[model samples]
Target: MDIATLYNANINNITTAKNAFDVLATTFGKATEAWQHEIADRLTAEHWTGTTATSAGTQIKNLGSELQAAHQELSFVSKALADAAEGFAAAQAHLISALDDAKNAKLNVAPDGRLTWDNESTSPNFAGTDAEATAKEISKRITAALNEADHADQAIEQRLSHLAYNASSGTGLDAATVKQDQAAVAARDQVPATGTDPDGVKRWWDGLTEAQQQRFILNHPDQVGNLDGVPAIARDQANRINLQRSKQDLQLQLDHLGPEPAHTVKAGRGSVENADYSAWRTKHDDLQEKLHSINDIESRLAGDKLKFRDNTPAFLLGFDTKGKGRAIVSVNNPDTADNVVTFVPGTTSRFGTASGDVDKADEMARAAKQADSTKTTATIAWVGYDAPQSILPEAAYESWAQNAEKDLARFQIGLRSTHEGTPSHNVLMGHSYGSTTVGYTMRDHNLPVDDVVLVGSPGVGVDHAKDLNIDPSHVYVARGGDDIGIAIAAGTLNFGLDPTWDSFGAKHLPAGNSDHNHYWVKDSPSVRAFGEVAAGTWRL
Candidate 1:
């Protein structure tokens, strides 16, 4: 019963646990590979229509069961290894107790394995003299060992959770199958079984005058008869032809009935030539005045602000009015402007705040500027429009989405004009509710862009980036680790929440894995990656 003996036993225990972990890691890795292949094969069968619907369903169920078993095995091994590591410390405790006994027996061993202490013969107590130092060293070693064990446990747990996350989402691989099924159902519903067309031939009959409609129905009684058993396309074509004939007959009746009602032209009206000249002059004057006013405003504004000073150009636009919101443009190299980053802020963004000169989009523009000073990048803080005040009120009312569409249109027109002659790598970056704004905008307006980056986004409501009219390959998303918004979006339990960040379909850069949306620092990997997008160095 000695200190050296206990330490050696504890070391052996640790070695055994480490060996167990190694074996478990290998087994779990193989299980993961197998499950991955199974899922892929099942999907391939589904994709190619190689299996019946029932068969695919059965395969999915079986795969899920297998994945669950694999996951359980991994979890079990991880826990066992962790427990064994803890048991090693417990064995060390027993060794410590034995050492106390040996010390009480008035014996101690030196580093060279020689007996160095004899408590019975000492003038002063030898055991008490060295107990404090020995105990301190033992406690330090125990703390270090415990920390290593905890670190190892955490590493395994994180890997398991990440694997579980992937297995559950099945995003990129299954989205097309789901979309196809939904589309098929909708197409089936739109075609009626009992009628030739859903609109019906009755609509064609109803278009004529009452007498004419009745006469036509009688003359074309067979066409007016039940349309069932007729092809929908044939019925549709027949209805269209009948409507065209009825319109011609009605026009003939109108032509025959019309000639008597027009009584006169005013006697004082001038000759055609004189009157036309006067009208033409009036129109010319009006257009001239408009042109002059526009020129005046353009000249005044041009003198007041720097004109294309940076490679970036500022966009000034008004909502329901002309000329109001401010946008600042700065390029990394005024001489060789390369990348252009347009920041669209969400919810209550304005210019010249007490905290700074811009809000929302402008705030992001500032961050872009700070991110890289020499990258020949242009950061535009665009208060694209007076955005809604909050998401809650807007979320409750769907009309906000319509307004967002309009704002997107206006911003795009303005952006196109601002970049009139310049070719720069353009990115439309949105944050928070701004992402939703961008989604609606891109869907409604075709803005020329190289990349679209969403940060701290809520659900964008687009199933995919392509749904927003942007190339799916160019869409990028990032969420910080602590971002609370990511949790909200992910847990919305609705597929419409922006899945780009969590799915494999689009390129989503790593956000700091933050818990809160607002606190992700610019220095974090996610932000730096975003910065790379802004710089046009990162391919989406």
Candidate 2:
């Protein structure tokens, strides 16, 4: 089968469906509104003296209700079809762009799925100046274009099939119906599952055209942001776009609530309007907090230097405003770094507290550079899980750690997949409850990391370093002298044995006389040792 031909046909069908649904939606929508306001209301008001007249009124009311429901269903289908059409069109455009690039590069594809460079051009062209180099470049471009086209063709078919199913089965504009439609769309287009091979994801992502990448990022930001094996740069791009969209959506919701009443109390407390106002205010405040967090990241990126880096740029690797909020930011391009460190924060972590976490990551990056100025190091603040919000019993339990393990493991896989050259000396550093999350992830899944550092850790969900699936020599721990709470809870509220203890069979680092939060501070021994570990220069 010719993939290009198949894609073209699907694009045409989508366009036809979009136009047809639009017409039905507009016609039926107007008729339904007219029947309800003009005919149904009048029929209800009539003083029917005869039984036949009353019966006719009842039938008319029922018909009006049916028409209203039909109109709503039609409207929903129309929008769905329109969105599908737009997505198809974008996919088609990207495919065409890729084809154009292939053509410009003088690459030819045979029906048998093989690419060849047309070096013997009859027409005068820029072919022979650097024939070998040009041929290699053309081969690469054609390969990428073909891969993108193939993926796009498959995606379009799946989406169209799902849309057809929904158009036939969906009944009304209820929440369930809407949710079903959304789930169908997501299932069709979401990134590969967590269990998918990281290498496969890397190959697929590397082959996509820039336009195709942008399309996925805009259409399915959440999936792209969390997708294992996606490049940090691409994830960052998608998450930032998603962040902006979320803020806009929230603002629109606030605007729809209309202007606040003048007579309402100043704080909108203890009044009839208070509840509604308070709800909206809370949403608004959350939106602002996220916006502020994003702005802070942007400001750091704009600066000439971020900690140790002189010109390296910062990026937002992941983001979410749902729940308590989660974010992952990289202080440098991890893809090309010789060393990389991912830091996970502990309790009460949220987007509102991201600025400080990000600062600490920057400090880590700087310290890593100081440890070995010749090696490139990237440090990421990975608040990519819903960490416990409080120190309550529920939060202190191991269930939260279990729930977070898969996500953390997937994130580490993503880092490995996107690396450009030889694998970096990757390190996982966790503090407090964050250590529990890392421990569970390492023990449950095969995380591609070189070193593990647990600081102010309660326990690592295991009695010994052997259970962590890493070399005991590579497992490091640091506990501040003042972190009495963590020391006391080591065998109680903690998951299992404390890594810093001699019985845990892990290397212990000097942490200095500081508290839980000061481990990463400048001039701290703990921070310096962490830097050395991340740089692969530390010794026992």
Candidate 3:
């Protein structure tokens, strides 16, 4: 733990140990990966009959997952060993180099790390070229190196304790979670805080090599999953892992709570509180809600056959259980898309309704194709903010809209920052009160979208279209026949001018016949017009 002990430490043995474990982990991973693929389809009902086979098949499938889980644990240890060895080697190198400098300078470094004079030179009274200052600098570097090595050692110890806990605990390792949570601790330290602005974050991300990025994504998925400036591919991979781990964690909690929850029992001969029952009920309800939110996300990720319709894979950009809940689902990879339309839903939207929002995204993508079939497109259902959950008081206030302005603008810019090729024609389409949110985003932040489409909007935070800082010609609006009440809310509710009005300077797009939610009804003119905007072919 001290300078002398570290100075004499032999890290070659550590390297040898790390190399051996790396090989073992790789070999084991390959074997389990093979096992994972083996039983996935081969052990189904068709391969056998009745009870024993069905039970074996289920357990075998689980065994495959557990094998992968064990492989991940092995990998975590291997990675930790490698980190420890590297930390020690770097620290030792610094110390040795410093010692050599001291020796060359005719200065002596004491066993206790103090500077001393040589027997011939000055004898416990010498410094470096700059006297005391040089000695201090050398001492500082020496201490820093030792501290760094100590940190690495501590990290290994912590991970070892965690590994032990996983083994002794009845709950086994989850296949999808073990690697990122345990193996990626080192990478996580290198990441910028989640609070960093999108553009700054993008600079750091783009500076890294592709292999480094991939490693970060594999090991530190939680850190990058919801990051605005990260590319869609990385975000998707990270968020998918996040989704798996979230489900596993929540399911584990639910299992631990057990089936029978205590209910309220009478107290004395009078009405009284059942604190335990109340607490249990509250926790149960909250967990169930979170589970529902996660399930909604799972449903939307059902791949090509469901919402995606075509063979395009779903890209989950973000998901969170904050506020009412938040989810951002993209129908395709936005990084490579020629046109990207992001839909921000209105009041009462939550994670429970995530599936419907993604359905709308799919419908938007389909409608965009109707405008121009050749254009690569992505439609995103972005409920990335804490939307107002009530109609009476919450929706009447602009707090929700104001709070979302920064993130929405950063997200739009992040799309431009990380996109693969030519600039995408990005459209910000807001439905109902979502328009209010978009309006704030544009007016305050000068959100750089190619077009702004307002559907069934009450107002968009600005009185004049020009105030949004976009080309007035690019501003468009639509309404539903049943949304008259929403129109009355414009201006009077302090939400700004009605965008659908001729004086607002935004051209009117066709409104749907039915209701506010029918704007993207299949084959509707309203949907097609919105699609035209996404396709960059819409004209006044």
Candidate 4:
């Protein structure tokens, strides 16, 4: 396809198909769920009994499962159409802009994207001295647009080819649809060689239609929920869908396990003799822990949007259920706030054990409000990285901080890129080894925060405040008199120089003999002082 042909591509037809498939997917899923509820209502353990009842229940479940599988297939196709439409739209816009530039330069662009001098003679258009160079630039852009459109077309053709695929399955048409989708999935693997810059991500997001964005969020929530540079509200909504879906999946897995055995037989050195029992036990335990972690997150959300001390809604900016898990949540929209403070919790604050950290973020917002009620403040609990799981084994390694650098930088950049109003005063704080993550990220990336706060730090991975990315005067440190482990770690382990040390030349906050874990205690001087800093009213 050439520039003119691609520019006039029928994206509207793809969008119409996408909308139709989207509705079909939603109907299938809702119908399955409704049927499940009806089955549960009818199949009472006390009343429904017998071989016939058991057979009926099993068949009923298979029907629901088939519908659910069909929903997945339809959703994938819908998203494929949405992706194709957006890709074509972007290419069309690119071509249009290039054409406009060519027209302004008084160049005649052909249908095949060839450019010539508009004066009907080989003459320069007065852009640069060389007319050939200007023509080449316009021609290059047109070529790029055409190439982009071709790539989109190739992907869509493969994704839509599932319509003709057949699979040999006893479960019939739904089974065939599910099987075909697997090949379609493999076909659309265009690959991600390098990540887009956060600014570029914002530009792409800005170019998307609302319907396109919604399809992305609904069909690919895992990607959209964690993506930087997207709006917080959209991220929150996507994450909530992800959270509920995960919980439901875990619950289903658990229910499928049925009841546990009365006794377990052990063999050899201590392993279970029964393979079935061992498998069931292992699966049950893993699922239970994951579910528990999810429950903790749900509690933090407080049945709806995470409510702070005030009625302000907190947004779940990101979440994951894998391994130790991760969560990034903010207690108010940073886009609308006058001040934004992001608190990175240190050791032992994994998703399952993050309630305390979330509470601290909440307290930080309240403290900021107390300092300057006139200004709106948003405090975020950023558990975006897998912090050192324990002090003895994990905290001692700088590797954890090293691994988190890119994600942390992107997250901070996202906050800056997505802000809607006047630039807000931004503060980044880290406690204990989290200070290590902040320090590494700062050293590596030009994080957009205005100030840095290191509290109860082992070290900031810098020998002096001047070594940090920000001005040395913008660095602030607060250390509790009773923060013994951190003090010892800073003095001996050599993560770097202690920020609170006078030689380091960083500003100070009053710690006043507090402990390592007491910084965010309600109404405490420490939380209030941190809040004041966030509110842009703190003094040395």
Candidate 5:
């Protein structure tokens, strides 16, 4: 297209983008306000009871959540489009201004692109003046203006590139992926690490348009989900989407493989078909296990009677299918809670076993509520690491814990960053090998938590509480009567010092006469102690 045609087309495009943005902004505002009002009204109404209230609350919360997500998505796209439009407009203005300046200077271009002074004008003729110098100056101004226009054009191109991803096309850049990419680009330089500017990171996150924030959640969930300085809600949303996508992809693979074997195999030597089948079976089984874990999460969120009685609602904050699989679910929204407790499981912990861990988390949540009914409590079941699959040599080593330290530390940071109003009294509670992970995390990096609780721990990867970098007084230890193996291993295996032992110098809490697995059981002394600790009411 000719330059004039291109310019006009760009103007029209900018106008269209701005108009679309305005429409979205209006709709988003109205919808969000309506959702908030509906939820508020439902929460305040006193006439509902039992199932009615439960169902209504769930539906209202879902609606509000959907509305909020839609708003964020729209906001990001609109802002991006608006920005692109403004860029194009500025470029056009620059070009126009340059042309006007040329005219004011009494400079004229012949049809063959030769420059000359306007003879008809009363301004000084180029013939007598320093014509070469004046021409050079005019040329310089025009070049700068063109350069500005070129930069703006490039900006518009970049913006359009992001907008071009659509599901209808075969480019595979769906809405979620597009959002994710945007977030990734925006956060590419702001990743949180040791010595990084945390406040600056937070400001960058806060400065993101809602769309960018949503996109970040959608695209780089693993990064955002575990990022120390991201809000809990964003993490939760991102994690959930990631989890669902993972499940869908796995299911699709399984479907492609079919329910039964492709062909009947002979019982003898391994063939290519057999190898393929074996690989497929392994993948299929792994996928099934992961799905089971996801189902457990869904059940908890749905308030299954068998899994939980409190129906406290659950929010998935992180998930992964790599290796043994990892999941993080909160019993309630941690962002608005008064107390938050994260429970990390030990050996044999995987997505398949996540249900039991989630149940334990629920129990912890209940206990916290029991300790202080007025206070809101959120207990997170953080299976966000590859735990030892069994009580083998691997379980005895510190590698697992070492590998998990950074993730655990970052998860704590995420909680602290996302929390609203006064910060929650956050506690990290670990059982068995999980305690080792928590210990390593505290030792390797600073975790912003009010307290650290170790129960039935083999060792904390440290010889004493002082080595943990946490205030000795803030470290609490409890051991069940039946955890004799863990007690013995603490000294024998160089797994570090036993926090429960007198030499470890951590506050001792009652574990009751229970087994290692029962430490978090409702009404158990260990559970009560955990409740007290989580509520910030624990005493020596």
Candidate 6:
């Protein structure tokens, strides 16, 4: 068979199918258009005869059916074209195979009908050379190594699965989904104190005394699986011994373990470990402080914004203050140009939200002012607009971002008017949706600001810091490990607001802790980085 001719036939079939589909689609389109025109004409008829109307209605119905059928036929033709193309490729492959077989054919004429090849000389006929022996040894070693490796890998996988099951079954913490975790913990706890360790449990049994091991095994009879190649007598004895020991240890722990603290609310669906008490206290204290400070802050929001005067230039009253919202004007020519910091809050972000009972927005400003208080810098909480109440009913991120942009623009314009002659450097700080606002302002509004500090950011809504239309070197980001929002904000696609701008190919300040809407305070990694930036050292 001619391969080219066979391929041509297949190609012709596909082309014909495709052409048929196209023609059907065109016909359907034209028929629909004509039917619509005919319907319009029939509606406008002056001689409303019943027969004439019926014929026109019949024509419309028939045309509609024809169009539907054409659409269906086009779909069939398209599928047929695809099938024909595949068939053509298969035919091409078969033709090539047949041609190859015909060229390489070997006819047998011997009485026994045995087949032979002219290229038989090339076949290996090893006669025990040193190289051949060495090759064979290498091959044998390689096979053994591969087998060992596969076994090791499979063993590890099986052991890990067992461990997962044991961990999932942990005592006193088992929920419906975590039974396997309980099992995992039980497996570890039930380990036999066999002086000869279980195969994969050497790590867990390392430091137990023989007596303790024997006791642990005694109490956990049901936990034993295979004895990991140990002698049957020894393994059974070890399991009995270890189980008894575990019972004693658990009883001793229970006796000493104090009752849960009155205010110790659980963090998640897990047992409170020994170290969590301190964490619980710290959070509790922080929350209390937040509650106490908010009321004091709400009283301060009613007045007009303030400014100060210092004698670096002989009673210069107004210096470097151009923007909307309240301003924290620094008096003297402090070492750093950025002697003032402005916070632009996002949607629904107001004075009361930061703390349960206190005006947290104002409290943060006061804390910032008190933090670095030689008049070197001051902080302003710019709640320029009434933020959206809730994200669900009305305040979506995008909608708030748009609202923030408008207000931030007005605020920036107002600030520019305030500091028309003053020349102090400026820093714009934002959080969560506020970061979006800041990013949009810098990129879209072209606000003249020095540095932008973003904490607990979801995303700046820009691809990179440079894309925010600001000086890339001045953008800073921070995220804490325990932050609930970080999971959703840390990825490129999800925009979980990861602070990995430096590693993710953008210039930014050192990342700090910004988890669950809480910015890290003094002594925190993020706070230290913020201090560095506030002091005008951008490299941190």
What's model 3's lDDT at 203?
A: 71
Off-target runs (Cα >4 Å) in candidate 5 are 1-201, 218-226, 258-281, 303-309
The positional error of residue 177 in candidate 2, measured at the CA in angstroms, is 34
Report the alpha-carbon TM-score of model 5 versus the true structure.
Answer: 0.62
Give lDDT tens digits, candidate 3, residues 414-487: 88888887889999989888889998998998666988988888898878899998998888999877776786
Q: Is candidate 3 or candidate 4 better by lDDT?
A: 4
Give the TM-score (vs. native) of candidate 2. 0.62
Error of 6 at 405 (Å): 0.8
* Overall lDDT per candidate, in order of appearance: 0.49, 0.75, 0.78, 0.80, 0.73, 0.46
| Per-structure clash totals for the candidates | 14, 0, 1, 0, 3, 58
Maximum-lDDT candidate: 4
Whose lDDT is higher: candidate 1's or candidate 4's?
Answer: 4
Query: How do the residues 1-540 of candidate 5 rate in per-residue lDDT, one tens digit apiece?
Result: 123532354567666876887797688779789768776575857566798888987877766665554555455566656655554555556556655665666677443324677454354643335545666776665554455455555654654564454323523223455466567545533445532444455656765544345556776776676555666677777777777788788788777876555544667675345666677788888878888777767767664743446567788777777888878888888989999999999999987789898888878888888888899889999998999888878788999999888778767876776788998899998898999999889888877887899988889888889888888899999987887888787767777866787888999899877777888777988888888888777777
The C-alpha stretches of model 1 lying farther than 4 A from their native spots are 1-336, 350-375, 420-422, 489-495, 501-504, 515-520
Residue by residue across 412-495, what tens digits does model 4's lDDT show? 898888899788899999998899899989988878989999999989888888777899888889888888878988887668
lDDT of 2 by residue, 278-369 (tens): 77677767766776776776667665345334656788887777778888889888988999999999888887678788888887888888
lDDT of 1: 0.49
RMSD of 5: 28.5
Candidate 3: clashing pairs of residues: 117-124
User: TM-score per candidate, in order?
Assistant: 0.36, 0.62, 0.62, 0.62, 0.62, 0.35
**Number of the candidate with higher TM-score, 1 or 4:** 4
